[model samples]
Structure formats: structure tokens, C-alpha cells
Target: MDEAESAARRLAWGVHNAVGFVFTLFWTAGWISLALLVLLATRRRDVALRMAARCWAPGLTGGAGARLVVEGADAVDWSRPYLLVSNHQSVIDICALFQAVPVPLHFLLKQEMAKVPFVGWYARACGMLFIERDNPRAGPRLRREAAALLGAGHTLCLFPEGTRSRTGVVAPFKGGGFQSAIDAGVDVLPVAIDGAGDVLPPEGFRVRAGVITVRFGAPLATGDASGAAGRQALADAAHASVLALLRRSA
Candidate 1:
């Protein structure tokens, strides 16, 4: 491309990012406010999840000009609860999953997130499970809490990588979430999210308009698998499934 064309494209990219950032702020503040009201009025987490699915997810994703496409959504049985595991790439991954997945999913977030200004309040109000990683007793407590939530027929979405990948590759899966699934006796649903890294790079605030694909893989049953060996097997299987989906999406 010529210099003029290249410069024009760069200018357009900057403008789009600027506008998207502003929209994201407003979207977050508005939904958080609504979430607070819902918590005060009804105090039901299901209602908050429905509101997020119908209003926040769609608006936030669409306003950022990010198109969300879900593959293998039919593989999910809405009637049954699942432990949804996915690869972590960027913050946009959360938005993409929330927009594409046709379910009221709850996240297993870090306890530190519970201290964030608006996000923490919203997460707490929605009854998301938070893990205090620094606390010595947090591991067992988290597993028990997660099991209880799953047993209560709530679907939990966890990033088995534990943190976002800076290299845009699927990292090794953690054993905690898989162990929770085993303890809860639920199906582990592997999900692969592609293209979110390009939309918003790690630790960067600028937004880029693009498409993100969320692919749900076949569920791996943790039947009678409560031991460490079983958890490792489940983790490996989930990691492989997510890697395959990422390759296919690419």
C-alpha cells in the first residue's frame, strides 16, 4: 500500500480505538449500576445473570464492534450444569464468552478482583465465587464452595490457565478447576476462544474492533473421578480440546 493509504488506515484504527474505549466506560458503568439495583431489589443471582446475558454482554460486545461467533453451542445441554473451562487470552475473552454462550454463566474470579472499583462490586453482587489465593486455607474452601455452587445447578466458567496468556497460546491447564468438577460430579465443558488477543492485548486498555470466536467442545465426564490422578487426566483432556479448537478456529 502507498504511504497515504497506510497513514489513512492507521488514523482510522486510532479513531476506532478511541471511540470504543469511551463506549466501554459508559457500558461498564451503566451495567454496574443496574446490577447494583437488581441486587437490592430482587437479591437473585439468576436474574442478574439474565440481565448480563441480554443487556450487558450484547451491548458491550456490539459497541466495541466485535462480532461474536459461537461454534458447537448445541453440544451444551442447557438443562444440566457444567464446569466450563476455557483458554485465557485477553479481557475481551470474558466479553466474547458472555456474548456468545447462551447461558447464565458465573465466573471463578480471583479475590483481588473483588476489590476493584466497579467490577468488584458487580462481581460480588452477581454472587461470583472469589478465591483468595494468598490465604492458606483458600484452596480447600474454594473447592468446597465451587462444588456447592455446581450442586446447586449453577454453571461455573473457569480459566484453567489461571491467568491470561501473553503469547496468545493456550497455556497448561490448572488442576484446581478440574478437581472442583470431579468433586462436584459434573461434566467439564472445554471452550476455546480465538481472536480476543488481537482485539485487546494483555495489560493494554486500548480497544480494537474485530471478531472473536468462542468454540465449545464436547464435555468430558468426571464420573467417579475424585482422586488426583483423575483430576490430572481431566485437565489434560480439557487442555487438548481447547488447543484443537484454537487450531481449527485459526
Candidate 2:
């Protein structure tokens, strides 16, 4: 691209971002309150999940001028529970997955997220799972919580890299979420998300309009994984599957 075109793109991104920031703050708060209300009134998670998958999530990505295209989600049996593991890029991955996947995701979040004001409150109110990654003693409790959530047929999402990838490259998967998957005895569904970081990079809110593709891979069974060694193996397999999905989509 020429210098003129490059400068024009930057100018467009800046103008759109100014509007997007305001829209995000209000749109998110409104949907969150409504989701909480729906959960409270209906006493059912599927209702909230439907709203997110159909409306709120789509609104977030679409509002950013991102065209989201999903594939392979239809192959999975949504009736059964899953550990929806995916590659992390930026916060945009959350909205993309929530819309791409046909279910509500109870993310296996960091325990610190439990303190993020309204977000934390909504997560707690909705019974989302939070892992204390820094606390060694939290294992048994976490395992029990994972089992309960999975047993209740909740699909939990986890970014096994544990944090966003600033370089837009998939990092090595961490073992904690894999251990939880094994303990819970649910299948690990590998999801690949491409191009989200370009839309909203890890550094800050500077945005771009782009296409984000979310592709799902076959679920990896966790029944055979037994010890710590087995957990590492599962994480490795999940990571490889995600990489393969990215390659396929690319």
C-alpha cells in the first residue's frame, strides 16, 4: 500500500474507534443487566446463552465492523457438555466465541477477574467458574467446582494460554485448564479464532475493521487422561488441534 492509503486507513480507524468506545461501554452494560435479569427471572442458563449467542455477542463484533464467519460448530453435539478450549488473541475473541459457538460459555476465568467491578459481579451472579491460578491449595476446590459445572451440563470456555497473545501468535497451552477438563471428564472442544487481534490488538483500543473467523475442531476426549503427565498430554493435543484449525481456516 502507498503512504497515502496507509494514512487514510489509520484515519478511518481513529474516527471509528472514537465512536466504538462509547458504544461498547453502554451496549455492554445494558446487555449485562438484561442477561442477569433473564437468568434471575427464568432460572435457566440457556435463555441467557441464547441471548448472547444471538444478540449481545453479535452486536459487539458487528458494532466493531467485524464480519464474523464461523465453521464446524455444527459438527459438535451441543447437548453434551464440553470444555471449549480456544487460542487467545485479544478480548475480541470472547465476543467471537460467544457468538460462534451455539451455547453459553461459562469461561474458566482467572480468580482476579472476580474483582473487576460489574463484570465480576455478573460472572458471579451467573455462576461462572473462576480458577485461582496462583493458589496451589485451590486445586481440590476447583476440581469439585469444575465437576459440578460440567455435571450441570455447562460448556466452559478456557484460553489455555492464560493470557492474550500480543504477537497474534498462538502460544503454548497451560496445564491448569486441561487438568480441570480431565477432572471434570468432559471432552475438550478445540476452537480456533483468526484475525480478531487485528480488529482489537492487545496493546489498547486502537481498532480496525476486519473479518474474524472462528473454526471448531473435533472434541478431544479427556476420559483416558489420568495423572499430571496425562494432563500435559491433553493440553498438547488441544494446542495442536487449535493450530491445525487455524491452518485450515487460513
Candidate 3:
């Protein structure tokens, strides 16, 4: 293409993204408010989760002109609770997961997220767990709470990398989620998400249209495993599964 045409296309893309970003803000706020009211009135987490998984998440992605392509979602037994460990690449990964995963999933977030404005309020109301990573007492507390949540039949999603990968590469996994799975006697499920980085890169506010793929792997059992050694083993296995899925998706 000529220089003039190329420049025009770039400007158009930027304008499109800016408009989408504004629309996303309003869309998210409206849905979160509706979900919050449902939670308050019914005190049923399933109601809120259904609204998010079936409505808000998909709405945000669709409004941004993004499509969700999921594979192996049937591999997940929605009837049972499992700890979902996934590789994180972008903020939009959360939306993709919620849209693709059939089960009601709660996130394991940093305790500080509980203080954010709309997000914090909605997260707390949805029964999401937050942990103070730096506080020494937080470890045992998190495990205890996680076990209880699992026992209560909620599927908790954890990004074992702890943060988004700027390079779109899967980072090293942390053992905390695996430990919690072992404590709760629940299986650990590995999910791989791709293409979200192209939609919204780390620290970028604008959302570019793209397709995001979410692939689920077989569940890794943390059977009869306990303590540091068991946690490390489970983490390694789950990481390997996720990395393999990433390769396949590529």
C-alpha cells in the first residue's frame, strides 16, 4: 500500500480502538451493577457468576470486536470443582476464560484488588478470594479459605504466573495454587489462552479486534499429595500441561 493509505489505515485503527475502549467502560459498569444487585437480592453466587460468564464477559469481548474460540471445554467436568491454573498474557485473558469456561469460576486475586472501586465490590460480592501475598499469615489463611471454597463446590481460577507476560510467553508457575488444590483435595486443571495479547497488550487501555483462543487440558490429580514437595510436583505438572497446550495452539 502507498504511504498515504498506510497512514490512513493506522489512524482508523487507533480511532476504532479508542471508541471501543469507551464503550467497554460503560458496558462493564452496567453489567457489574446488574450482577451486584442480583447478588445482593438473592445472595446466590451462581446467579452472579452466570450473569458474568454468560453475559458480561462475552459482551465486553464482542463489543471490542473480538471472537472467542474455545477447545476442550468439554474436558472439564462441570459437575465437579477444580482449581484452574492458566498462563496469563493480557488483562483480557480473564474475560476470555469466563466466556469460554462452562463452569462458574472465581478468581484468586491479590488482596489489594478488594479495595478497587467497582471491580473490588463486584469481586467480593461474587465470593472471590483475595490473599495478601506479602503477609506471612496469608499463606495458611489462603489455603484454609481455598479448601473451604472448593469444598463448597466452587471452581477457583488461578493464574500461577501471578502476572501478565509481556512477551506472550508462559512464565514460571508458582506453587501456591497447587498447594491449595492439594489441601482441598481437588484436581488441578490447566488452561492455555492465546491471542488476548494482540487484543489488549499489557498496560494498554485500547482494545484491538482479534480472536482469543482458550484451550483446556486434562486434569492433573494432586492425589494424596501434601507439603512443599507435593506442591512443587503438582505445579511442575500443571505448568507442563499448560505449556504443551500453548505450543499446540501456536
Candidate 4:
């Protein structure tokens, strides 16, 4: 590489890491402080959500202010529990989504993340559901857990795609989260996240602050059907919604 290009690349990396570290440090401190206060004082749902909002506010403001441009953000319902399913592009997609919908958020994460240092503990404490991808009974277990959460009237944020897109194109969903929503009789709110891949692509340490739009479409109600055919139907519809948003922006 040329000297100028190499220098620019190095500068980008340095800025990205420096900004990310500072952001994480502040967010972690704020989150732990709020959590402790909440844990000590009260367990009211609104208070808990307020505390979550505080912890999330910094990242949300910084991320959106620097990179994200949200559309259809007003469609999010703060008063009800909806099964929010989105297309995953990169890890920063989480921040974008949280910024868009700053409610009491719970993630349907992979079991692998449950082993991470502080993230796992935080996720577990916040009642995040972790699915073991390899287990034979994982699907059924997740369904049961999801149903319990649904019964309690808590919203869930899930990536039906199950993993980040290697290419920028959205991939097929695993059908587990969809089936759980169907079983629990909840509507799936389709979220389309655009430009996150360009902002922070998978397998890259550098970040390019750019406009990332998150669109919320009409929710899909639970269908009584089951098996491959039923799951595929939901997947197709969800995929179509995201594709439509992307095409519109394009």
C-alpha cells in the first residue's frame, strides 16, 4: 500500500479503537451504577426500563448522531410487547436497534455469547435468552422460555437470521424465533436495518460512521401452522419486507 493510504488506514483504526474504548468505559460505568441502584431500591418494570434507557442513551445518541439515520422509528410501540425481528448485518446493528427503540430490551442471543466476560453477565441479568445452536432440544427449550416471557408481556428483540451476513445481502432465518412467536401467539415486528454493514462490517475492526437507517414495518401475527412450510412462509414475508425497504432506499 502507498504511504498516504496506509497512514489514513492507521488513523482510522486508531480513532475507531479510541472512540470505542471511551464509549464502552462510560456506558459500562453508567449501566452498572444504574443496575445497582435499581437492584437495591425497586423492581418495578418502568424503573427497570428507565435504567436501561439511561445505560443505552449514550451509545444511541453517539451512534445515531455520528452514523445512523433512522426511518419509521415512530412506529415502535412502547406500551406493548412485540416480537421484534431484524436482519443482522454487523455487531453495531444492536446499537442502531437500541437507539431506534429504547425500551426494556431483551435479546435472543446465541449460547456462545453467554460465556463472554461482562456481556454475558449483563445479558443474563437482564433476562436475555441464549440458544444452544447444536442441542437437539434447543428449539423446544427456547420456545418454552419465549412463551414464558410472552406470558409476562415483555418485548423480545431477535435476529431470525441467527448470524451476521457474510455478504451485505440478508440471509434466511432459522425459524426458531418465528416458531416461538407463533406458539406464543405474538406478532413479529419486522425491522429492516440498512447501511450497518458499511458502517462496521463483520470481521473488521475499523468503523466508518455513516447513515444507517432502521425501518419498522407492520407486524406479522402468529400463524397456527407448523414445520418447514409454515416457517418458510414467515421467513419469506420477513425477507420481503426488509428487501422492500432496501430497494426503496436504493
Candidate 5:
């Protein structure tokens, strides 16, 4: 696809996005409610997360006609917890990751997500930490929460770019997630996602049914890295790794 959608594609996109978005909402609501109830009743967050990855996520991505291709997953040392860092491309990235990543990925979500109805409940129940990007004062608390989660052996994933790019270019990495990684002394796993933007662009959650590939890169050590400098360096290194993976996949 070019920078802009063609007239013919635009019409198809409208119908696809409208039906897809509505379907996603109702589908998600039903699944999330079931998961939430199970979690609330039995206090099993793992069950909820599993339902999401196994049932809800596939519906979101595959139901939209997005096919996934995963690479370098075997290279990952899944035995230990590492902070997952990936490029932001499209709304499908989340569902794609949920489908691609072998583990139940706890995402660093924006604080505004707390206000979102079913999603908010799901995030909290699953112990996915909220990122208060707009409030600098929330850093220490966030880092503490993040470190606790990591120390407890939960793998986390976040798009350091903060948001999806309209031009389909990878954006600069934000420092918050990296800082959390540094504080926890967790290794950073760099992931590259290609063709997701084409499958589902920024204009709307349109379905293209294209091949979306997720490439996993080697983990960067931040075990001994310290302070603000460590965070920035780790973030830069991870960003570079993601870019290289994208290039290789291209």
C-alpha cells in the first residue's frame, strides 16, 4: 500500500473496518467478561490470560484476516523473564503479539486504558502494569510495580514507541519502559514486527489479510547496567536491534 489508500481500497476499508471493529468489541466483551468472572471467582489470573491469548487474541487478529509469521522464537531463552520491546506499527500489533509470543505477555499499558471498560478490568486482573506517561511523578511507583512483576518472573512487553506511526515508520523509543527494565535488572528482548501496518493501517482497523511477521532478536543484557545512562543506552541498543530485524525481514 502507498502513503494513502486508493479510492477502491478506501471503500473496502470502510466496510471492513466498521464490521471488524464492531465484531471485535462484542467478541472481546463476551470473552473478557467470561475471563473476568473466572478470575474473580477462582482468583486465577493465569487462566484469564490464557483465555485471552488462546481465544480472544486470535479472534481479534485472525478474524480480521491477518495471518501471522513468527521467526527467531527458538533463539529466545524463555526460561527467564525479560522485558519485551517491539516497534509500534498498527492496532493489530497487540493481537499479533498475543498470538505470536509464546508467553502470556503482560503489556505496559497507557494510563488512559484504566478508564476503558472491559479492557481496563482485564488488564488489572491479569496484573498488567499501567504506565503513567503523562505524569512524571508516577515514575517511582511504576518502576516499583514493574520491578516486582519482573522479580516475580513475569515477562512484560511494551512498544517503546508509545504509539503507532501513521507513515509506517518505526518511531523513537521512549525511556520509561527501559528505565523500569534497568531498575529491575531485567534483560531486554528486542522484537521486530513487519507488514502489520499494511494489514491494518492507522487510518482504521481495516483488514487486509496480508502476511504479518514477528521477528525476535537476541536479548540485550541490562543486569549490571545502572542509572539514567544505562536506561538510555539499553533503549538505544534495543531500538537498533528492532530496526535490524525489520531490515532482515524486509
Candidate 6:
């Protein structure tokens, strides 16, 4: 088989197994599994995140293929709290992000997603914060919660573009997430994910397997920079870093 056909088959097989596992967990494990996840979340957030990943590990392996690679992660201080910003692609981006950063991550998600069945429950239990896209109070609430999370020494992962791009191109970055960093007083780590859009294109449920690389750029310097200059700097750095990674991969 050629590259494309091999990729499609691998992707389908992986996703199929993953759905089966989720169903098994729902029936066999039942509430016990959900309880265990909650207990784990309370006792050890890192382990909880790891377990979350394990629940879909088979699909993750198949979806990413052997070409999935991570680069430049050693430079991060896993013990300390830092803002992780990345380019948004497909739903697969969540799994890739979690695996790339082996730390307890709190994602800034949309309020609408909080209504999903298992996923919504998991996100809430994991202490993931969600913002109402159209709510005027959203900004203030996000800043407040972000400050609290950072104060409590928890790391956050947010997509600066706010939403997934319809096209493969990285969308323009918004400054609000960076503003949260200023409020929380932490450095922002820019992450770039290559080929996720192609792997699971946004257009449909069909999957195409290939190399999905997660690249980490050096932490964007926040230092004394704040307000517009700082936000712009962070946004520019994130876009440039991801774009550069894509170019390198190509």
C-alpha cells in the first residue's frame, strides 16, 4: 500500500478499538471507573491525566502512527507552573498536547463543550475551566480562575487562536490568554503541533494517519512586558514558532 492508504487503515483501526474500549469501560467498569477517575484526580492530578490518556492510548498510538515524535521538551521545568500555548487543530490535538507535556494540565475550554457526555464530565472532574464564548463576563472570569490556578501551582494549556482553524493554517492569536499569564505572573511556553490537521482533517470523521510532531519553543519572555506589547509579542512568538515548525517538518 502507498503512504495514504496505509495511513487511513491505521487510523480507522485505532479509532475503532478506542471506541470499543470506551464502551467496555462504560459497561464493565460503570460508575466504578468514573469514581476511580475522581479519586485519582483528587489524590494525584498527574496520575489522573495519565490515566485519562491510557483510556485512549490504543487509538492515540494508531492515530499518531510510528512517526509521532516530540522535540524540545527537556527544557521545560515540569515542577513549576507555566502557561502552555499551542496551535489548535483537530480534536486529536488534545491527546497530543497531554502526551507531549507530562504534567497536570488544565485546559481552557468553551462552555459549550461542558455539556458533552463523558468528555464534559471528565473535563469538569479534571478541574478544566470553561468560558462562555459570548459572555461579556468571560474575560474577567478567565483571568480570575487562571490567577487562582497559577497561584495554586497548576499549569494551564490554552489555544491562543480561541478556536480550531477550518483550514490547516494557524489562526491569528488572541491576547487574552497572554493577559492571563500577566495576571498569574508566569512564563508562556509556545508549543507547535505539525500534521494534526492532515491526520484528522476538520472536514470529516475520516482519519488519515501520519507523523504528528509536537514541538516546543523556548518560553516567550514576559518579564516586564505587559499590555499590548506583551500580548502581541506572545501571540507573534506562538504563531511564528508553530509556522516555523511546520516549515521545518515540510
Considering summed lDDT, which 10 consecutive residues are worst modelled in model 5? 1-10
**lDDT score of residue 236 within candidate 3:** 88
Expressed as tens digits, the lDDT of each residue in 89-144 for candidate 5 is 88778888887878767988989888899999899889988988778899889888
lDDT of 6: 0.74
Residue pairs with clashing backbones, model 2: none
Candidate 2 lDDT at 188 equals 91
lDDT score for residue 101 of model 5:
79
Query: Among all windows of ten consecutive residues in candidate 6, which has the lowest summed lDDT?
Result: 23-32
Per residue, candidate 3 scores C-alpha lDDT tens digits across 164-219 of 99898888898876777887788999999988998888977767789899999999
What TM-score number comes out for model 2? Answer: 0.91
* Sort order, TM-score high to low: 3, 5, 1, 2, 4, 6
What are the models' TM-scores?
Answer: 0.91, 0.91, 0.94, 0.86, 0.92, 0.82
For candidate 4, lDDT tens digit of each residue in 35-100?
756755775545555565555644644643456677776766667777888999888787777667
Best by lDDT: 3
Whole-structure CA lDDT of model 2: 0.85
The stretch of ten residues in a row with the least summed lDDT in candidate 4 is 57-66
The parts of candidate 3 lying over 4 Å away from their true place are 1-10
**lDDT (Cα atoms) of all candidates against the true structure:** 0.85, 0.85, 0.87, 0.74, 0.85, 0.74
Residues 122-217, candidate 6: write the lDDT tens digits: 677778889887888778877898878876888898998888878878888887777777777788888888778877666655455577789988
